[model samples]
Target: MTVVTLARPDDADALSAFAETAFRHTFGHIYDPADLASFLTGWNPPDRIRAQLADPDWTIALVRGDGGAILGFVKLGPIDFDLPAGQPSEDATELHQLYVDHEAKGSGVAAALMEWGIAWARTRAAILYLSVFTENPRAQAFYRRYGFVDVGRNPFRVGNHIDEDRIWRLDL
Candidate 1:
């Protein structure tokens, strides 16, 4: 059995371990090694996550297994993106990352984290939004199934790879 809980700063190390393993296994084949390394380290290192847990504005939640391992996490917060040349700005609470360890994938960990994130944002009167790599079709499909509709695209480069970021939104 698995349990979902709002992550506290004490779970920082566990969060980093899960983030590294899950992300490495899932995206290692799709993204360049160095870029993927930078992404994981930049976002979920223990120290950084500890700081985020201390943040008053960010909502960070996690899913844990019966043994109390942090299986997955979702981080959401208010953000303003300055649009590129023909785009307009948006008021958004971005889902920075959602990841589940291989052991926890089929047990509904992802859904629980997402549900918590949506509720967390709703309480703050913020709309839910996220950006998924265009190449991650499975993730895109999953988001769509959860009532997230694609509203825009961001064309950008990550390291040596050219990628399109599909933006999806859900009403709070």
Candidate 2:
């Protein structure tokens, strides 16, 4: 059985490693090697994960498989992207990252993580925001099923590379 739980400080190292691998498995082929390395070093380093784990404003939920191996995770936190004028920043939360291991696809891990993230976001803000790579139709479709709609496009930076990402929002 798989279990979903809040990420603890002790899980940082494993989470960091798992996050990097999951990201690479899904999107590494699209980026230049240098860019991918730089992005992973900055974003998935163990210290960074530890810091996030300690931050009261950030919430990371983990899906652990039968042997306690991480199968997937989702991160929820304050918005980091620029919102359009008239969008209430204080009323919005961000789904910063939602990833499942390649081996766990179709095993319901992503849905479980998304459910946990949405419930967590609902308690903190009236709206939820996220960004999906324009090329990733599967992720876009999954988000759409949760009532998320594309509001605009945003530039997502990975090292020196910039990719267009679709900004999605869900009114809680």
Candidate 3:
């Protein structure tokens, strides 16, 4: 049976590699190879994952398969960008990243990770925030099922390309 649990420091390297693979599989075709490489190297390097693991504020969780291999992961933490004045609740945490192995699609791994992330946010924040690519209707629908509403728009850069993103918030 698959199980979701907190990620340990020793899992950083594996998580970094899994995240890179999952991300590339999900959105690699939509961007230039160079841009994808830039994003993978800059945003999800092993060092960054290690740092996040060591940070107390970041709650990183992984969904492991029956044999204990990681199938997916999620990270929840404080918002990284400046929020608009007087809009989002004061106690809000960001669902920074959620990635599931391509082979694990339709296995409920993503939903489990999201459930863990939402519960994590509930402990410290009243609202959960996330950003999804504007073009990704499937992901938007999934978030909507979890009560996330589009609150604004932002630009997410993949190398030199600026992709539009819809910011979503879920009130806990």
TM-score for each candidate, following the candidate numbering: 0.85, 0.96, 0.94
Maximum-lDDT candidate: 2
- Give residue 131's lDDT in candidate 1 (0 to 100): 82
lDDT of each: 0.75, 0.90, 0.86
Q: Write the per-residue lDDT of candidate 3 for residues 97-170, one digit (tens) a residue.
A: 99888888788998999988998899999989898999988789989999999888768899888899988989
Weakest lDDT window of 10 consecutive positions for candidate 1: 80-89
Question: Predictions ranked by lDDT, top down?
Answer: 2, 3, 1
Considering summed lDDT, which 10 consecutive residues are worst modelled in model 2?
A: 83-92
State candidate 2's TM-score.
Answer: 0.96
lDDT of 1 by residue, 22-129 (tens): 767876787888877666667568898888788877867887666777778888875544334433334447787898888777678888887778878777654677
The deviation in Å at residue 80 for candidate 1 is 6.3
The runs of at least 3 residues in candidate 2 whose Cα sits more than 4 Å from the true structure, single-residue gaps closed, are none
1-172 in candidate 2: lDDT tens per residue? 5568999989999999998998898899999999999998889777877888889889999999888899999998889998866666888899999999998988999999999899999998999999999999989999999999998878999988999998899999
Q: Which numbered prediction scores highest in TM-score against the true structure?
A: 2
